[model samples]
Target chain A: MDPKVVNDWRLRGQRYRLEGELCDHCGEAIFPPRDICPKCHEPAKTPQTLSGRGEVYTFSTIYSAPEGFEAYTPYTVALVKLEEGPIVTAQLTDVPPAEVQIGMPVEMVTRRLRTHGEEGTIVYGYKFRPASFWHASTQA
Target chain B: MSSQHLMQPERAVGIIGYGSYIPMYRLSSTEVARVWSGGGRGPIKEKAVAGLDEDTVTIAMEAARNAVARAEIQADALRAIWVGSESPPYAVKPASTLVAEALGATPYLLAADFEFACKAGSEALQAALGLVGSRMGDYAMAIGADTAQGRPGDDLEYTASSGGSAFVVGPADLAVATLLGSLSYATDTPDFWRRAYQHYPRHGGRFTGEPAYFHHTQSAASRLMEELGMDPDDFEFAIFHQPNVKFPSRAARRLGFTAEQIDTGLLSNLIGNTYAGASLTGLSAVLDVAKPGDRILLVSFGSGAGSDAFVWEVTERITSRQDKAPRVTDYIRRRTEIDYALYVRYRGKLKT
Candidate 1:
């Protein structure tokens, strides 16, 4: 069995659906969910699913990618502020780096993050795309 | 074997909602020809290309979410989720499981992956109808998605593309389009196939026509119409599995359907062949503009060789749900063109 599989499995909720902890006492949203809340030091045991709709708080374009991501050089990564009040750092897709703007509305989409190797598991996670991409004209 | 009559579910079943997903990037056939053949156009104008981070799994998930949104039903209410794809991301893993998980329809859901070349999506659609009609499940989702590949410089490269559609089948009363009947025709013709451990598929060229696509598509459509006591004139729209622009048009004309009948549903000329997604995406496009009481005829052909023919009638629910999610034509219009180098990189045609 691959060790990476266990780690990926543990993070499926956050990776697959943007599931995070909602603080019951403080009524605040927490992402990459820690069991305890940072705001009030309360137990944030309740699970909440984010709307996956957000605006780009900030971004950077990586012309030189790190190991394992050389194929995706010139990709843009962004800090997205979710509608539910949580900030997430994720890769942006479908739009060119030059087109990326701060405060741009984006939506979450499931996409391949990386693969371990030729025979290893292919890891999939959430990425953001321009919301306008989904609102094309009905007339073809 | 040919059925004496069209198959009906134990109870009335229909599509509660439907949705389609086409990737944002496109690769022009002209670019493909420029690289290899020294500049001449290929069959279609351009083809949708999935990004490096996109695959059958992601495409299926997006389509499923749109379907659930249009159905106006809770994802947990869906009892079954089936995905049909020729180019699933993993050879060993099931794409359906991941889709089910992403939709929050896990544990209690009956999920599985299916393959039958291009007809695979309709295969799942038939099973969904049966599941809902039998009263075993109130709602079931059938998805046909693919990130199809062709060997570098092969004729198939010009047309192979990525896209998919999903349908939620439920009781007729809640349906946007009701399924009237269905029929299937199959044979061991081996017109196209990929052997084990092979990355790309091979075809029998001209043999894929006449004996495989035409024979099975015509046989199934003719037989279904015959058994249902209907004619091409009875349908407002028609959809056929589109490998390219020519085949489906020729098949439609030969089957007595007027060009106008298939005009709205003919999308291959714009987006290329999406394999298992071919016919289902066409259906989604027709449903986008179909009026209530309109009838639709759909026939899908797979290369291993088989065809699934279905008859559908739109209902008032279609009008309200058509705008709940992005329409098929919307995806068609949202495009970003890339040169051959970027296309090859995105599709992983060139190994690292």
Candidate 2:
């Protein structure tokens, strides 16, 4: 694991609260917030905390585990369309890979992403769980 | 009664909100015996298992969020956050700080971690009551959660499970259930223990029965009743720390509580013993069905051993606050069962 990846505590607010920036000119929403709005070509001054509620735009199940995530193989990764007009990529949790659908409603939850190793610092971040809009009972 | 002096507060305090969480995956008792070559006889049918990414911190966060949702107040209004858990993610870092930050309740709040076996949650609850009762804070949050552990083929394996419960304690006017009074009893009876740097706990086997669990629980419950001049018949419902189904039932009978009074809170039958979260979760379940003006008795026992007993009266506000978040039964019903192999993988019990 990269040293920088394990120590991303500097972005705690952005990651934990989904704090993004909004373009004051074109109203463009940017996550991992940038100083410059890509669409308006202007400085994004307004800060926007996302609703943390979204819909699954697309998804894939990883049968082969990644290098740092071997313990959690066969997990679902999804592209979620935030209600605030930005598409964010994240790992889907709580719901199994087989049950993930393109239109599933999801809400963000803080969870452990990966650890460096047995003694390494654990990386924690936001993952999406199926929201109440989608009936958990309906999922067969 | 010496215990009467410790029971109620000058100011009324009660639970403003409460929440509970159970991980989705489950492992059946049959699968446990199959993997370890033990007989199929087990204490309970199945136990909840924390996923690879889930632990005490994550479970606590979920429960706290639900509690805050039901609380209907700004998270920052919480002046303190205390978590009681035997399975904190970090040995040094406080789980309460992480939980507070995740819930956006940081910068100006007291945070700490607590441990006392299964009664850890009640310890935190007691402190929260003090903070709110004495006007130290308008509200405080206390949580009990664990990702319990057990060595292979141990009886603890059949009972150790994962879950969490949280309560927002505040003034009685804003409360769902008013705290009538509480009492605690402790003795240096070593029924179960886990030393620092140890993964799983060791128990004194049958010694846990007569001298540890039974003694403390019976003493605490009996003392609380005697102090308040009340008995089991006074409370509409009663919840006791459920190491297994049998201990609580036996303790209830000894304390003169009938089976019906303990039935709704006996969640250990389905989710196994959640340790710190055991009695708290049972209390949450009881509060879900209890009506206004109903009285409840909640007692939690932790090995070493000790018990904290509280008398609560359900308020008219309970019905309004319950629908704010998912109920305890909702989490229990939304489970996916896993086999022994998957359970081992999820728990990270596989040795390198």
What does each candidate score in C-alpha RMSD? Answer: 1.6, 2.4
Question: B1-352 in candidate 2: lDDT tens per residue?
Answer: 3424456766799999999999988888888877776556588888999988898999999899989988888888999999998889899989998888788899789999999999999999999999999999989999999999998789899889999999999999999999989988888989899999998899999999988988888888888888788988899999999989999999999889999999999999889999999999999888877899999999999988899999999999998877777778888887899987888788878885
Which stretches of candidate 1 lie above 4 Å from their native place? A136-140, B1-3
The TM-score, computed over Cα atoms with residue i paired to residue i, of candidate 1 is 0.97
* Model no. 1, DockQ: 0.69
DockQ of each: 0.69, 0.48
Candidate 1, residues B1-352, lDDT tens digits: the string is: 6447588998999999899999988999999999889999999999999988899999999999999999999888999999999999889989998998888888798999988999999999999999999999999999999999999999999999999999999999999999999998888999999998899999999999999999999999999999999999999999999999899999999999999999899898889999999999999999999999999999999888899999999999899998888988788888999999988888987856
On DockQ, the leading prediction is 1
Question: Per-residue lDDT of A1-140 in model 1, one digit per residue for the tens?
Answer: 67789999889889998989899999999997999998999899899989899999999999988877777878999999999899999999988899999999999999989988788898989999998754645432
